[model samples]
Target: MTAQATTSEPAASEPARRKTAIPKNPGRRDLGLRATLLFPNREIVERYYVPVIYTACRTCYSEQDPDEIFRRALAGDFDSLKMQKLIGSVIESGHGSTIEHVVFTFAISGVSRTLSHQLVRHRAGVAFDQQSQRYVKFKGAATMLPHSIAEGDPDLRTRYEEQVDGALGLYGDMLQAGVPGEDARFIFPNATRTNLVMTANLRALIHMSGLRLCTMAQWEIRRLFQLIRHEIFSVSPFLGSFLAPKCVPLGYCDEFNNRDGHCPIRPHKDRVLEAWAEKAAAARAAGRELPVT
Candidate 1:
């Protein structure tokens, strides 16, 4: 009698709950990003971007001929930081051509198709050759599902699988219907990923890295830059050195979002200017000269 009463308590009052149809985390997922020098190699950079920037620097201070300056820079005589400071100012001042003479090529692979789509949108100063979807038939096409959907509330996870699976099925049907591979690929979602190799000069790489490495950049593409930075570091820490968050070399952050002066990679430009003004006022009060850069 006790067992029967205990089991009968309150079935009607218990809220109905949906059952989970799937489980999560069968295994680790890979970002699968990779980067390596695809062209110009180590020899080319050790010979070029350095000497190129060096010449750009020395041309300002030297009485010697520009060609003569290039010869010594290529041969190595002056400190790199002095050259870098001048180059930095030139870049900041929008004289970008001085850094354009050198280029870096990267083999970028296994990034999401979603990222590659946004990445190829860069209209100027970069080149890319992506793995073709048009010519390649899907013997077994692969796809990426984000961790959120991968390890998600069960009903949501089921919906995501159904969507991806349904997409693949439609793609196969389209091909079977004699649709062109390109047209059929319209059914392919961003989760259907790809690889590419890209080449860009130092100026462009710096420009792209600044925007892409920022916290504003989409996470997958940011991861790609992290790998790219690692690859460049492997080749030449000296030159690979320049490809970084713009804040790193600027000594002050310029990000609009950082206007509150958070991220301490550098003082925000606003804060820096405020500090300068305060210093100038203090100097005037003390009847002393304020040094200027």
Candidate 2:
């Protein structure tokens, strides 16, 4: 009898292999997205935001009470540059609690439900109030057309649009047929538009921006963060500067998908470690220990 053949197929419970290629940087395009800074305009941010964070940082080292430190900061008792420098250093040092004392509220609109789902996943130090599909039945509901599909083959684009429109038309028909709005909304696609009011502390904002600004992020969410960064910059460039890709501050890209170094914002961690190893090896060969920082 012939021996039974062996197979290398993956087990049924095993997860599918994920794509490794980092997505292309979706350069800013008009998606009709808007991110408006609703609270703490320029004057409020300038007058209070910095001082609030500064007081949090200074209170750590100073014997002075936080209220007194905040008062001094507000009264211009500390040199503006010096205060900013200290705040920057503390933030760089990963003393995140200091920055958590301040928060920014934004009115985000015209973003896809897909993006909103990702956005709400950030829960720490962030609060979100989103438009409800169940409570507010959408009339002539708007949907987002992804840049790729919008610019793809003419026939493909029409097909995509027609499918989405058909679903929306069915949703309306279901509603008219006495179906609950919640049930009708089951037909809505991820491309459906959503609005949210998000208020996040500086620490959470920085962390979220770091992730969503990365090239590996979905294009719609990346574009949302871009608009968010722009809004923050309009009020405070110093604060906005902190909202960058995680790799920018980490000094090395740690994304597993970026092993090919496709995103050029920074070198991959593996390469950085490899270079360090090589330097240490050369030092050892030369009968000298590599100095550690």
Candidate 3:
């Protein structure tokens, strides 16, 4: 039998939950999300990269041997423009495995632990090695102050900074008192800065960029993808063009949270379906069938 609550038992106090406010117009500040591409420079891509992907794409359709195809592609036996056109068309058609032959590595640093936690969730075709909090005893640990908190009322901002500083100060005190670093690190806030090295294949990179570059994505993570896109553009604009919000390629937004259309990047999928329904209804009224794709 379930126990009954005693009349004298004190009621549990619930903390007020803060509503998540996605900034409609966030004033641009340099959020410290740095993504530096560490591999596949222009020379590297120009040399053997396209040939490898082209070979992968052609092997399925051509009677020519794979090695012979790679040989011709690398030696420029085919026009560069023609090769690029074919590759672009293949990628646009959702042949993702062809692009998986190429990879990019990045050195990411100075992002908050919150962002890192989100970053590590992409498991397939990506690898990460992050700085260890359990091992590295930080002497002067840094933290991120979100734009909202920084730009809010000065009194609230001051209080937030003081609370963070107070936690850090206590961490230092605990360490000085011979406490273990791992144990003391429990006090670190989610805003604490972190570093990571990430490597992902082109297919995985494009998949991640699609989700993270959307207007509805968290501002910090969205900014990181912007920087990552910039890095890819530096090396190869052709490949960089493919890294965009999923909605851009789909021509409509599918995020459940965006059904109200607060983010105006694209029309909501529900709205598009509703319009189609109305059109079909009108066609039915006219005793005709609406064409379907």
Candidate 4:
């Protein structure tokens, strides 16, 4: 007979692990970051957006030509609800190209250089044109003051503000003393505000939003996505509804940073996998096979 291995749980006297601290919500701020949808206004989205995406989806399975499918979709020959259902099904099944047919253009402004550095990391199916520091000499450059610093010890906050102002002041001094704008910009801090015109396909937008909208993302970028979601909702709530943290669609959180389960929005994937393993082992001990999903 084969011997079975067993494991014991931690002793009752063992100290409980300390829970990770959850980040405090950053309250509303006048922070100038704004995301404005620059293309496909409501009329265009209502009239042709769905049909265009539906055409892309249906083209894969139907014998009909793609343009004919789009024409019928636009003419209301196909049921609107049914088209949405099909599109949703295709999206959930990981058929990303179906949604890539649609794209959004956004005028992003007043964001810090810090956020821009992170934002540009997303290079797939996206394009960005940023306000050039070398070409555009900023007469008045703004900076971001994070909520934590603004609301912390008063002296510390004052020092932080003064430091930022001094950097901008030095930048201006350099420019006035015949320094090239490009050379003067060397004094700009990461908090310096910048502008960008970003264009991304639906697939890439969703993927970027999934990472940026999560509770674990940097506060400033998370807020930016919140505004982006609002802009999308203004054009088409049906499409905007799809933008959410990646875990919302995956049914479990995969972020290694959330392994301690502090966020509480969803169970960590590691815990879920461990639970399944335990269940399978118990089933085997009973001489029965556990079913896999």
Write the number of the candidate with greater TM-score, choosing between 2 and 4: 2
Q: Which candidate leads in lDDT?
A: 2
- Model 2 — TM-score against the truth? 0.91
User: Deviation in angstroms for 220 in model 4?
Assistant: 0.4
Report per-prediction Cα RMSD to one decimal: 12.5, 12.1, 11.8, 12.1
lDDT value, candidate 2, whole model = 0.88
lDDT of 4 at 164: 84
Better of 1 and 4 by TM-score: 4
| Tens-digit lDDT string for candidate 2 (203-230) | 9999999999999898878988999999
- Global fold similarity of model 4 (TM-score): 0.90
Residue-level error in angstroms, candidate 3, position 268 = 0.8
Candidate 2 clashes: the total is 0
Per-residue lDDT of model 4, residues 12-123, tens digit only: 9999755545453333445667899999799999899999999999999999999999999989999999999998999999999988888999999988899999999999
TM-score of each: 0.74, 0.91, 0.89, 0.90
In model 1, what are the clashing residue pairs, if there are any? none
lDDT of 1 by residue, 1-293 (tens): 00000112337878865433212211223455567778777777667767777787667777988888888777777666676677767777777777777777888876678989988988668899999999987755667566666556979877777887788888899999999998998888787767788988778888888877765577677767777777777766866677888777677878887787555567789999999999999999999979876
The list of candidate 4 runs beyond 4 A from truth reads: 1-24
What order do you get sorting by TM-score, best first? 2, 4, 3, 1
